[model samples]
Target chain A: MTTNKSLFLIPKFITTPSQNGVGRYVCQLQRVVLKFCKNHGSSRGIREFIEYDLLNFANKNPEVVVYLKPRRHRGPVIKAEYLNGDDQIVFCHNNTREEIAKWLNLLRTQSGNHDGTRLRKLWHTDYPSIQGPWTPYTFRDPALNLAEFPNEELSRPLDQPKTATEELDELFKKQQESEVAESSEVK
Target chain B: MSVLKRVQQWATFARIWHVYDATWQNPFQSAELLKKYLMGIHKPIYHPMNDCGDHVIVINSLDIALPGNEWAKRVYFHHTGYPGGATWTLAWELHRKDPTMILKKAVYNSMDGNLQRRYTMERLHIFPDGNVPPELMGNVSNQIRQIRPMPKRLDHYTKEEVEKFPKIIDYPKDYILR
Candidate 1:
């Protein structure tokens, strides 16, 4: 289920393997949206789109459990702090918790719009590494607070598990050793 | 609290992609803006866990604008890694030589380390004219629902050329949802 009210459509530019391309594309794209919003009254048009969609959906059926594919605990990506070898760093977020809280508060406080989304029922749309057999995390953020962003642990040090290639190499080595032993026994 | 929410959840898991575009004073500025638009950071939907950006289509690559004499002065570097294998070309050379690859290459340079972004970028379409060929139009791609930058007939570029750029041609607004 989804609502037009506040689904943050962050365009993760994973189209090209080249890092420069992603940045270049993002930069150009930002300008366009800025221009569009400027020409079309920017956020106002967006607000209108949201109101129209929500009202339309509500009219059809009052019960709407819209699942938003939003960013995880949108906060600051602070360099991980390792405390007593108990470093709890996770994914690297762009903003810190304070910044996120500030933005959320600011967006919510503004009476100009259809009541900002305000982190309503958060969900983390996972993007993983290419070589990774991505480990699945639960959709429901148990620690999520409607008024608050996720804790600073948003930027976690990605302690990657055994990679696919590494695992394959290990398997190959074991097989090779077994074959060698069998040959030696036969000889 | 039913098993069906899982089914509903499964049904709801959309393969949602992003779409971004820009019309610059010139291709340089256009490509610059287009880069940011496709990256999804511009949108509120950005997620670190998942790269949430969409498929971007950059029209009007030929007319990209550059600051000052960047077109003439800006040089792109390439390394062969063999003695004196390094080569360089000015931005002007690239645009004229291929034109299509200039903006694409510019963007490629910007996205340095993100390997996943490399895949999501396949959705991007860069055309010199507003009227791109039919194949480039978003209508054909099931993932691309609408053509943003709304397909205008830029100066001298034909409507046909614009249509060619989008995956869909003569598509109704409701075509994708239907």
Candidate 2:
């Protein structure tokens, strides 16, 4: 089969924004810069978000510094600077107040690190195993070490898949054997 | 268990080093344990779909223990995708062929069949013995406790130490000499 061509394979990790920290989390978003126009039709949603939701968001996340810049005739844009020295710019031309809020929330929650195209792993940790990792010799029966391979007993499957009817028949046979043994003991 | 503690846990993520010693431990249990790390089940942020697991370094693959007659009974099946190209290798034979294959297969089989399984397996570092490469040494942060204690070899003990070890009984003078 032919493999498809791809632009990237591995994901990229950022500097400061991390989800797997050592029992501590540092707020990654350092500051947010919002640029909007005073009388532009496209800037209406951003203006509404600023007027209504911005104050609450700022109050809730006191760690994040929020700045509002009003330009003469520019379209609205939101620029977020992360602690990792990366800046994410979201164009907000003709977006709604709810959409702006959603975008702002996304930026706030992000660790500022982007996994480029292919992620090597989803999770990363320092302490991987608590008990231990398994290996081939972990639970090996000592008999196998000394015995030769392809031996009669070991060469067969460890367990044969038994059906319910077979199990009942075995039980009946065991009961008959026990009863016969008791009768012989009485004699 | 408190709400405040829960909130703090939700906010903070800790990366810990885990080491798994494969000496004399069952391969099945080892696979189960590694699956936890591969699937990120050991972490608080573990979601079935999320990659939030830690790295696992397994040592002593050559000395790993297997239960029952699995050495000969267990078979690892493979296909070449060609006509009459199926192959079945016995567990012991596979181990002798490649010491790490048994453990790798066990851990691999334990994982859910998905694209993410490949990503999870990447975090697992396996070694046949104590000799770890320099590059992988940096990735290891902490060691997980051994499931089974390392069996002490007779050569490892000093003469005095072996003599000092308590004896079950002493031969009586009256007892018949061989």
Candidate 3:
């Protein structure tokens, strides 16, 4: 039970086999029902679609069972059933023949009724990383495996500048070289 | 999951053991450094709710340095939950009682006051000196660098090195001995 209201009410899912089209394509729509009145102004476009395009649609997809229900004084409706035990309904009342055909094609291509559900991710991957997941020893130096703990060299902070003692030593060496050169010239 | 993926999951969440040398380092600064390792903040997969913290073994805690006058000014307070039971101990006095107490308190106080603070502190192992047990020392795979360099004492250097060092001035024969 999630505290989020939207997440709790609506189901969330990743793209699974029910929505995949990778290797082989399988039509998920199992059946479709077009219900329209026999003699009504609203059913005019649906009747026209049934007379002109219904045969071609049925012939193209033999897997889907298309049914026609002629009712009296009823608005037109398109109902789609999927193999995943989910169904979708679209009201085609007063819709044009072209619009009805487009709706039927959309319902036929979808894997299932994904409305009222949230998509967890936009993309999916079988292998998340090319190299591998990161580990503690992934970028670590191999020398640490053989070295002893509390090592002075490893414990010291890096990039320290010269100290006063070192500076004084350098100055003393330069002065001594100058004195040696003076003595050599005199000799 | 396959065996390889299971092993990869374990590798990503593995609790690493790190060693830190506290010699000649300030306790407060070292505490800030050690807190990150103890809480697993140094890892790439760190999450506030996840248990990904690593173990830290801190050695040479007895040699920890405190800033000027901190040993005298800093105090630890305690109450016995009774009337007239309040007590305050100076930092130096507390350190004298327990060599590891200063650094331990430092790391403890550096973390947030959450339910996981006590559990996170449990992973920190502080020793008074470098005499750590062989079993614990064997698990350490990484070392935390000290914040400050360890200054070399004059007596620590060899007699020859000291004598060969450049002299700034020569003392007069009539100079009075201090």
Candidate 4:
């Protein structure tokens, strides 16, 4: 077997246009992944290190590790690359929706996260203030298969992918209502 | 809460200086050159010895811009390891949730790996709304000028907008400098 080179694309801290608690979870992830990668030794020959590389690689390899934080850490840390399916190993932190989608596509499931999936499913469905009701569009997905995407939506000349932003807004409204209802029930 | 005191302001005595708006800009998002620029980097100060301080007062800490397509897709994670395990949130959502967090993150990231970076970094002040504390600035209004992120300008005029009019294209009788 021919060996390939590994690369790194580590984003330090990720926050949004909205004010949200980056939460302690992502902070720790940044520390762990950076510290771990910093300590690990990497050889040469790495090429085209990017998200595109990882997504394609993951789609081709089932033996790849899909880590979403709950019970497992994302992996195949041994050697990473865009070629030879080396990009399949993703070191994602901050639990972005794209990462969730990547793992979901990799595991081929939606919503119902099994005990051992790539991403660590957050228990609190209600993400702090702004992190919830997952937004409708994302750019990075290590396991997104274009064929599985919504063809019906694209049947017409599409200008941009329309998201369920209104739906999410409604979800937040409902969540707020439920919270108010629960508070009144207790009162 | 409350911002820390401004500490001290040293007089400008260098040939070159830089200004940054971390509030409206991602300190880390700058290409390699911007980092070198902010660090007082492109200087012939030569020796890697002492610290050469520069002033960077970012206004409107709540409105720093981010790179393309990242606002919605990217998420930040943290893990406390309770039964709840890890937590994740998109950057765009954070802005909607709390606008100030992103700017602070940018300043920190921009200054990362710089020597004496922390001390120099603190000199930056960021606010929730787009407000700059002019009182602290005194008559230094010139120094407190708003930092506009360098926009890419195309200097090349289109063929239609050029001075190449039929007769005007001929050599001008005299050239004048603006």
Structural similarity of chain A in candidate 4, as TM-score: 0.14
lDDT of 4 by residue, B1-178 (tens): 2232121112222322223334345434532323444455544342345454444444455656676877887787768889898889899887787776666566566666766667656554545653546554331211222234333233554766433322314556686756
Clashes of 2: 31
Q: Report the C-alpha displacement of residue B69, candidate 1, in angstroms.
A: 0.9
lDDT of 3 by residue, B1-178 (tens): 9999899999999999999999889999999999999999998889998999999999998899999999999999989999999999999999999999999999999999999999999999999999999999999888999999887899999999899999888899999989
DockQ of each: 0.01, 0.02, 0.58, 0.01
DockQ of 3: 0.58
Better of 3 and 4 by lDDT: 3
The TM-scores, one per candidate, come to 0.34, 0.45, 0.72, 0.31
Ten contiguous residues with the weakest lDDT in model 1 chain A:
A27-36
Residue runs of model 3 more than 4 Å from their true location after superposition: A1-13, A23-82, A86-122, A170-187, B172-174
Superposition error at A44 for model 4 (Å):
53
DockQ of 4: 0.01
lDDT of 2 by residue, B1-178 (tens): 9996565444443443356778788878889977886566866556776556777878789998899898989989999999999999999899999988899888988887988888888878888987777667555544454454444578888999667554446889899978
Candidate 4 lDDT over A1-187, as tens digits, reads 7543224333223322122335521111110111112221231101112233445645554444433122222221221222112223334343343443454344332112122233333333334436322211223233433422112222222243444544555676687799999999999
User: What TM-score does prediction 4 earn?
Assistant: 0.31
Candidate structures ordered by lDDT, highest first? 3, 2, 1, 4
Give the least accurate 10-residue stretch of model 4 chain A, judged by summed lDDT.
A26-35
Q: Tell me the deviation in Å of residue A100 in model 3.
A: 13
Query: Of the candidates numbered 2 and 4, which has the greater TM-score value?
Result: 2
Candidate number that wins on lDDT, 1 or 4: 1
RMSD of each: 32.2, 17.6, 5.5, 33.1
